[model samples]
Target: MSLPFLILYFYLMNFIYNILVHIAYGIIHFLSLFNQKLQLFIKGRKETFKKLSVIQSTDKTIWIHTASLGEFEQGRPIIESLKNTYPTHKIIVTFFSPSGYEIRKNYALADVICYLPFDTKKNMQNFVRAIQPELAIIVKYEFWPNLLSQLKKEGIKTILVSGIFREKQLFFKPYGKWMRSFLTAFDHLFVQNENSKKLLNTINYNNVTVSGDTRFDRVYEILQQDNTLDFINEFKYNTYTVVAGSTWKEGEELLVNYINEHASENEKFIIAPHTINSKKINELRNSILKKTILYSERNQVDLKEYQVFIIDTIGLLTKVYSYANAAYVGGGLLTGLHNILEPATFGIPVVFGGNNYTKFQEANDLIRLKGSKAITNQHEFNSIFTTLKQDVNVRTTMGKTCGDYVKNNTGATQLILNYINNLFQ
Candidate 1:
């Protein structure tokens, strides 16, 4: 194709992309009228630009972008490490999802925490002009074309950390030529594995490095922290404990049934549901036949009296995993899986429903290492549960495998940091 025609093609593609983004924005705005979460999403973006207006342009800024809270966790170690190493540079964090922004808006490490503006060219231009970041680090797979292209045009150095690419992704498809062009915007991509690096290489994109996943580093660091929970200590009391983190309805049902049918006098279960809604909490409480105690109401009742403990709060799941002999990380039976690494870092044999976990390479890696199990139904759950409970040698072996998996995957953050340091020097 001629240079002029190729330029025209690029412009036309961008124009269509902007139109689709605007249409999606309109739909979200309409949905905001009925959905409280969507309302907060819209409200948060408005507040974000307002917050950005006051940020001084004189300060050297490092902008980190994450899709949600999970990606935030992946990027967090890097953020802290960068802040410590370069104390003069102001670290700014932006979230594409409302959940991440709402939860971590008050994060101490970030000088500014806000929602990323819509991916329109104008919004991208305005945001880049306001922030004027020296380096932009996008976590995981959030690839916003307009923002990236604008950053590239302005000569702002951008890199993607903890990036994973699969063979089936749109970037490799015939119709994905336009999307693939966005990959060129990045100065470097610090990917999660060799498979991702190879996938990028197939497209002749050599500016890639296999830095592993930062989540492993984050979980390992969590393990090093003081994870003492007084109530958990009292509740366990030397019992063989099963900590089920981030349970959904399907996972909870299976767990409740297993507890009702098979729980022994010396066995205990701790369930922390994904949502702490009163209705869902009550539903979970009533479903279990055993004496179940809510985390909030535990102080009023004797902890040892309950065989099933329902965690009715947030931010304690990782710490709660420290008290487990085995763990069931949930959400696999529903949409996807939650963090199995949190429990795995504690050296516990982890279990979850076998559904959609292909994107999470660690989940599959854990299975291969005999550190975790993916159950299809109650029968599989029972078998796995029984074995982990009865066979001490098996459990110990699996637990060690889990710990080793995490330990082996460490230092991705340091690798990424070293590259970033070189960029500055």
Candidate 2:
């Protein structure tokens, strides 16, 4: 296509995209009346512009935008490093999801933390004009066309951190040239692997660096923290414990069957499901025929007497991972794979639902490196865990592989900082 024709084509495609965005907004607004999650999403953004009005033009601000809590975590290392290196600069962190903002609305590091208003041309323009940040950092997989174009038009420096690109993405499709142009909005793209870089090269996005995940650096730092929990020490005393974090219903059922039928007397289990509500908690508790105890009942019972421990709470899974001999990091049973990296950093052999984890580069790397195990059925799950429990040398080697993987993958934060240092100077 000619340059003029391409420009016209993109404008038409962008108009269509904006229509879809508005339609989504309408659906969300209507659904909010009946759904609490959608309600929070709507309520959170109501004050975005009013909240953004507080950031002055003269403020030396760095704006970090993340789609949700997971993306926030990936970008956290960059945010903290930026804060420490440039203490005078104000950091404004914005989330597109209520899950991230609701959890970290008062995050001390960011000068302002709020929900990013829905992507419309005016919202993008107004939001960008008001903040006028010196630099903008977008964490993994958010490609808001209006927002990115607005930032580029204003000559703001924008980069993507911990970005993972695949050939399967729309950007590579024959019909995806409009979305491919969106990549040009970013000044630099720091991706997780060379494959992502090569994928971008196919689209002429050459300003790319293969900077591994910042979360590797985050998890490595976990080794320095005080990961001790007294009740866990008591319950997990000397016995081989399997710690499963972020277990969805499918993973929970598979593990429960193993606990009831195949588990040895010396083996104990700790399960932290992805969802925590009374009905879900009770359903899980009732299914385990073994002496199972919920986290809420910890103080009331003899912790060691129970074979299965259910953590019906949040914020403790990472710490609880320290007590595991073998770790099952959940969410692979379906599509939403949780953090396998957490357990991997703890030097334990991590197992997860097998099928969907190919989308995660870290999971693929770990699986290939023999640092993690992926199981799709009860038999595979039983065989893998049973082997890890029975064979000390196999367990030791696998655990070492996981630990080494985490340690070797550290310093993505420093790599990013090296690039950003020049941006400041």
Candidate 3:
């Protein structure tokens, strides 16, 4: 690692990063012509600068950046807490994904909410100058060299919350020196687990805390809120209810097969598919043989008449979990798992497609602890599904384990808040 070689490597990675960033924006711009999501992404960023200009608090700002809806959940507790702790400081929340910005743009807690501009050096410089953030909080896996470097250059404190680091990631690779250089810019890193802290320590980043995931705190808060949904109560009506939340095509196949072949009249199902487009919803609805009703028809039909319910929209799945006897959470089959913690908080036995869940710590732990079951295919699913319906003791025990797991993982948000409070003190 000669100085010349190190310098050259830094220049090379920087060059490569710039090219990739511009190429990504180009691809997104081109695809926006055909895709509605891409159109939103492009359209939203067009107003980012304007949004920043209108922001009233320039220096008295706490800027939080989240990649999407999931990361926003990780950041939400802090956003609410910070809003209460420092009543006058403005919070600017930025999203890189349209999934997050579109859903939460009108959030009342944040003074400004907008899509973060593509991280060009100029854009990052302009954004930093415009917001002049006193502190920058990033929720989970977002790294932009330009933005991070600009923040560091301006002497702004920056931290990452609910961060999970893996050895397989670029930051741990042999050729990762260029990427690793930016880690020094962080004033602190609040990670999800001890292993993440260890990984950062390996890189000599000891300003790291194993504060766990803020999503734990977020889900725990769900317990305090009124999770009562009159519609869910009507649908359940004392029957055994299984809620399949965020189901993808592969997960839906397993659930549909089990429902069609094994379900009794006493068993009721509510499926909230990951993609709720009309075509995807119809495909799922058509696959099932039992009497099914869509959420769109909730007001129009008799709720108890249908054995299966398709939640063909967003925002209702969290509340629906409260009525579940056993929960089959989706996303593990194809797109990684959705929030099992949502149902776990409600004290329900959680089941999911287990093929792609080894990377998720909670998923692995839940399976090991017997709080949740992961089924690979139809046979495994049948076995688990049958057991959940027949054995009340087992169901109650597993549900308790799931509930305890959620209860134990909370307090990450408070730890982060304490650190932020100490910084200002």
Candidate 4:
């Protein structure tokens, strides 16, 4: 293709893309009238720009973008490390989802945390002009063409961290030329695995490195911190404990049935549902036949009388994993799987429903190393649960395997920091 024709082609494609973005924005606004989550999403951005207006522009600004809470967790270690190394520079974190902003809005490491403005050309240009970041880091798979284009036009260094690319992704398809152009806008991509590097290579993207996932480094740091819970220690006093973290309806049903049918007096179960809303908590409590107590009501009730404990609070799941002989991380049976690395870092064998394992390489790796199990139904859950509960040797071996996996995958944060340092030099 001639250079003039290629320029016209990209201009037309971008025009179409902007039209689609505006249409999606309109649809979201229409749905906000009926959907509470959508209402929060719109309201969050309104407040976001209001907050952004107050942050005085600084030349030493570092902007990091994440899609949601999960991506924030993946990018958090690097944010903290950069803050320490460049104390004079201001750190700004932007989230595309309300969930991430709402949870980490008060995050101490970041000088400012706000929702990323919509990816319109004007919005991107204005946002970049206001922040004037020295460098921009995007987490995981959030690719905004308008934002990247604006960053490139401003000559700001940009990179993607913890990136995982697959052959089936839009960028690798025959019709993905425009999307492939967005990858070229990135100065570098620090991918999680060699498979991602190979896939990017197929598209002639050479500014890539296999830096592994940063979540491992984050979880390992948690392991070193003070993760003690006195109430949990009291509950698990000498018994074998199974800590089910971030479980959903399907996971809860299977686990409750297993406990009722096969659990012994010496074993205890702790369930932390994904949501702690009273209705969900009541429904979970009613479904289980075993004597259960809520974490909120732990002080009022005798902890020893209950065979099951339901965690009805937030910010405690990761710490609770330290008390587990085995762990069942949830979300696998429904849409996707929650973090398996949390329990793995605690040196516990993890089990989850076998639903979506493609995005989570850690789960597949753990399964291969005999450190985790993914089951479909109650029958399969029962078999795996029974084996881990009965055999001490098998459980110990699997726990060590899980811990080893986490230890081996550390240092992606350092690799990313090294790259950033060289960029500044």
Q: What TM-score does structure 1 among the candidates reach?
A: 0.97
CA RMSD per model (angstroms): 1.2, 1.4, 1.3, 1.4
Instruction: Name model 4 segments beyond 4 Å from true.
Output: 2-5
Better of 1 and 2 by lDDT: 1
Error of 2 at 221 (Å): 0.3
Clashing pairs in 2: none
* Candidate 2, residue 65: how far the Cα is off, in Å: 1.4
Q: Rank the candidates by lDDT, best first.
A: 1, 3, 4, 2
Model 2, 103-194: lDDT tens digits are 78888898888898799999899899989988999998899889988998999999999999888899999989878877888999999999
> Candidate 1's residue-wise lDDT over 1-425, tens digit each?
68898799888998998899999999999999999778988888887778887678687999999998889999999999999999998898999887677778899998889999888889999999889999999999888898988998899999999999999999988778888998888999999989999999988899999999999999999977999999999999989999999888988888988999998888999999887789999988998889889999987988998899999988898899999999999888877888899999989899988987767999999888888899989999999999999999999999999999999999999999999999999
> Looking at model 2, how many pairs of residues clash?
0
Return the TM-score for candidate 4, rounded to 2 decimals.
Answer: 0.97
lDDT of 3 by residue, 229-341 (tens): 88888888899999999888888888899999999999999998877699888988899999999988899988988899999888888899988999999988777888888
For all candidates in order, the CA lDDT equals 0.91, 0.90, 0.91, 0.90
lDDT of 4 by residue, 138-169 (tens): 99988899999999999889999999988888
Count: clashes, candidate 3? 1
Error of 3 at 264 (Å): 0.4
After superposing candidate 2 on the true structure, give the runs of residues whose Cα lies further than 4 Å from its correct spot: none
